[model samples]
Target: MSNNKMSRPADALVEVADEHLDKVLHSMAGETAVAHDDQRTAVHALVAKRARVLVVQATGWGKSAVYWATTSAIRSLGGGPTLVVSPLLSLMRDQVKAAELAGLRSATINSANVGDWDTVMQNMESGDIDVLLVSPERLANPKFAQRIVPIIEHAGLIVIDEAHCISDWGFDFRPDYQRLSHILTASGATPVLATTATANKRVTADVAKQLGDSTLVLRGSLARSSLRLSVVPGLGPLERYAWVDEALGRIDGSGIIYVPTVADTERLSGFLASRGHRVVAYSGRLEAGERERVEDELRANQVKAVIATSALGMGYDKPDLSFCIHVGSPDSPVAYYQQVGRAGRAIERADAILLPAETDEDLWKFFATASIPDVDNIDTVLQTLKESGEPMSVPALEGITGIRRGRLESLLKIVAVEGAVERRDDGWRSTGTPYVYDEQKWAAIRTARAAEAELMRAYASGRGCLMEYLQRALDDSEPGPCGRCSVCTQELPLGGFDVSTESVNAAQVYLRGADVIIEPRKLWPKGVEDGRSGKIVGAGPGRALTYADSPGWRDVARVMSGPDLPLDAEIFDGVVSVLSRWRRQWQRPVAVVPMPSRRHRLMITDLATRIAKIGKLAIIDALEVTGPAPTDDAASLVKVQALVAGLHLKPGVTLPTDGPVLLVDDTYRSGWTMTIAAAILREAGVPAVLPLVVHQLP
Candidate 1:
């Protein structure tokens, strides 16, 4: 792989490719596009020699132009539709609209528009669709395979946008993306073009192997002169919000503020809104229309900024996104680059600011452990499928195996990529592919990711030139300092790491009032005891003061969760304040009941005693634990059974019979403990139970 990896086979073909690019540009934007030599070389490969091409370039470089130009050239010569395997639904929608502008008929088949899938398939079969874009996950879908895979097999050209996802070594590797290999193997002589802006040498090599042995990888200088980078260090979660709130007025135009977790998006966006900045929260959890609406709002500059999780960045087209601010640094520099690249794509200059938090590394490790497949879990899934000799839906599998839904889904995707399992229209079935735990391979990957994480930490600490640091991490051809970043010029944006006292106080107040709701479980885990076989009834919602290491009340949560310690007066006051606000949402509880915990009984009891005193409510011990606590690693049903068997409304107790009671606990994890406690109370004739906890594990 070289910066100049491909050359024109002949002068005439170059001329034709350049002409096609010009046509694509004129049709798409009615403006002339500069003929980057590598772009022409890629188009020539698709049009003339029909070669496999992989392009690794900068963010603002027009990777889409190469494929659109080739599609136009190939279609002019009577070729069939070009299949594009895109990652995100938002990206696919943007691509389809862009294709139409480039004089090509394009339609997407994704999870969101099942209704449009049939019509789009018909168009593809009828040759009316010149560019057919499908998400990588769709290729693995049984229904999509039965319909579109056949048509796509004969596609004139295949383009994989954001091609870094094809590599297991990629910063944002997706297991569903491995299905693209099936297409590559099946599309006999069709020209293939894969493009991405954020792949290192290692990821590039892996993706090229997936493309083909002979694939031409065109590497380019990843120097984005338009992006001026800076870092604001040592900001707590609340302080970060305050800094953004105060800086909104100074920031030039609408941009994005990236947060580490989905929950933070809403919290940050809400705080910014209260400060009189028009903003919206964006996350993958949002519905398709809502995500699109947010994207459109940001693009139109109708809002100050979109406080979002990292999912909002990739392939989102905003020409003049003025600033890219991060509340916490991502685990890797590649991921950080991919995110900040969303800005300055069509502008003279854009600011990329990072506010690094101390909690980011722990979050990275947690998410990493969650995504990696457990050997025993994978074996259980495969062995169960083998014994059943029939397709098993994900829910059925979960019931039988007791793997949680989220982890099970992630595991299946990873195994499916290895051909050890297959998902069909009916359900998932084993493919008889023996599951081997590749210790060496997995260890190597972990090592690589660990190195990348350390590199990011180095970047945050200002070890070297910021631009050169990113370029080197990405293995850019020309890695050099831009001489415009905070480090090089000894300047910092947004007040040089000092936030206003007023703003910080305001943020702390807002955070203290924000309590995350915990929805009660509706259905018992399958395979539980006969007494717990159906829908859960008589359970009410609950609330947690802090979740997942939120800095809102970090010290308070620590003190509350510690063993046998009395609740601090300040902590008790915060709970009272929360109770004051939560009172509106529910009927005032007549009594305070401490949800019995063997380990933290004194701590919880102390807190309950104080709350009982404050609310002028009767203090009662309505529930008590007799049996052992649930095994931490046990299945959901087993955990439920442990709690159910142990938790008995105290042997002889008189309940309030009509009013709700505050069920106080120190921590909430799994929520089964609280659910069973509430069910016991309701069975004993209490009308409702309101759970209050200090910490909620994510």
Candidate 2:
């Protein structure tokens, strides 16, 4: 197990046994030749001696080939199976297919394939599996961890794909990836291979330290010569969407349009389709089958583009993908580079353009905060679990503690690593281990994030080579201008594409027509079982122009903020447009009622009066704000209580006993206010309440 025994000369190329190596190479490349001798030699040496290695190569540099070849070489020598901890299901699917082509048996155990886990395990036990791909989250499953103990004990090699996720400095860091270090420690002398295309000096050094001092680090240049990089900054949301729609027709080959949010994915996809483009929306919200189908469509060039969020990222193999356009900038240069790398992999040249919006910084800040664990919240969760003295499911914990479900799960994973909690079949329980909140670690992460954001701003605005700037930001050894970027070639434009006034107007019209559906709460949140908090009755469908629609609705929502701000013409037109489109959904209401607002009474009154005037319905004063305003940050039950006590029927108003009424509000968030308002109206003898709002927060 000595480093010396496992070491090979840096300059020496080890000749691997040709019998199995040649077969693997032919199967992977579809030819009887190997591309990179250095990569092949390094992987072969690592497999032969069972040594730890780190491969820092650019995307499309055939990193997968190295691991597949290593698996084949080791298995040929009568070694145990290779375990690959992939980060995404798409990556696993691609890897499994590639392994099969290389004549290596591969199977995956992930959330999507629970029904096939038994079969996979059977194959592994019977020595029919050469590589077993599992997600990092799978490592946290107690049953899977227990079942994989023997396999890991004798694993021939452990490949950590997307290894940057293991480091805190990495842009896509996940708490579940930390579990791999523990597994590595338990694997004894098993050789490990970690790979990433997006890591700077800090992230690489951090990962190397975690892997051990004996780990051989192989670093390569980060520049993608085939990618032609450019940026079109300062585009408003509507203009950006318009530009993307226009550019898709000009860009060669099918590609991807990356947005930062799920809402944008749908909005942009719909807008593009309205403009006569064939595209699909791909996000985390899509079902597994849908995602697979979209991936297939993209591979077969059946669509012009797939408007997607980051859910389509990391190991989605489309060899001829010719372009990648970002509607908004990612938070960091590393992530941006990794995403842009998806294009031009097997081609001579491709386009990588960014349309940075004014609101991208705000979106980045919100997501960055969401990822960091809050110190006080973590303490509160740990104390609650300790007091319970027994395992509690996430639902029960959400009831006892007021934290959101997603944040709570993230905190639990962090504490589990610190030995302060453990996940059991029943739920999660406190482990009584003393845990110190690492203020310094989080502070450093925050500082690094700020620096990365600043770097992104430079990338968007600075006069320099975009590819070289990214390379330098990633600390590439030989960072220099690629002579292919918009700046380097003196072809930088204020806009990425020629968007006509007609296209812009069409985009605006589409945005104005966009409406979000507000589904009634069928069941109340747990722990709120009182009469007022149970299943809502007589709740009809609601409609809104958009939910936190960036750039498009920013001005419209601003007008709804203060008491004196008048409702502008654009917002009024937007409301009119939404109502016209939603006419079929609810038809015309018999009456209109304004939900009283303490802050935006004027705006709400104006909106309700306009709607009533347009629909030729009688306007009625139905509800009043009777209590002090509820804290916006309060928990759900607290907000519900405030709304329940605050809203009441007007003292002298007569209710319509058996007709539908349009309930109006300036904005909708959490749906508590609307729920309580509808319940009040229904209790006051209205047959149905249909909620309508100008804006809804997503």
Instruction: Name the best candidate (by lDDT).
Output: 1
lDDT by candidate, in order shown: 0.83, 0.82
Q: What are the per-residue Cα lDDT tens digits for candidate 2 across 1-698?
A: 23342343433214443445667777767675765765765576566656678888899888888888877767765778899999988888899899999988899998888899999999998889999998877878788788888888778788889999888789998877875566755554887888999999999998888888877888888899999898876677778887887887777899999998898898888889999999999999998778999999999999999999999999999989999999888988889998989999999988898888887779768756667898888888989998999999987787677776777888888777778898988999999998799899889888888888888888988568899889987999998888888888767433345678888889877876667888876655666545454577746889887788655576865665655555788778888888888887674689899888877888788888888898898999778888687666655665666677777778878988767999998888788888888887887788898888887886
Using all chains and alpha carbons, the TM-scores for the candidates as numbered come to 0.95, 0.94
**On a 0 to 100 scale, what is the lDDT of residue 465 in model 1?**
85
lDDT of 2 at 88: 88
**Clash-forming residue pairs, model 1:** none
In order, how many clashes per candidate? 0, 0
Q: Name the weakest run of 10 consecutive residues (lDDT summed) in model 2.
A: 4-13
Quality of model 2 by C-alpha lDDT? 0.82
Error of 1 at 205 (Å): 0.7
Please tell me which predicted candidate would have the highest TM-score against the true structure: 1
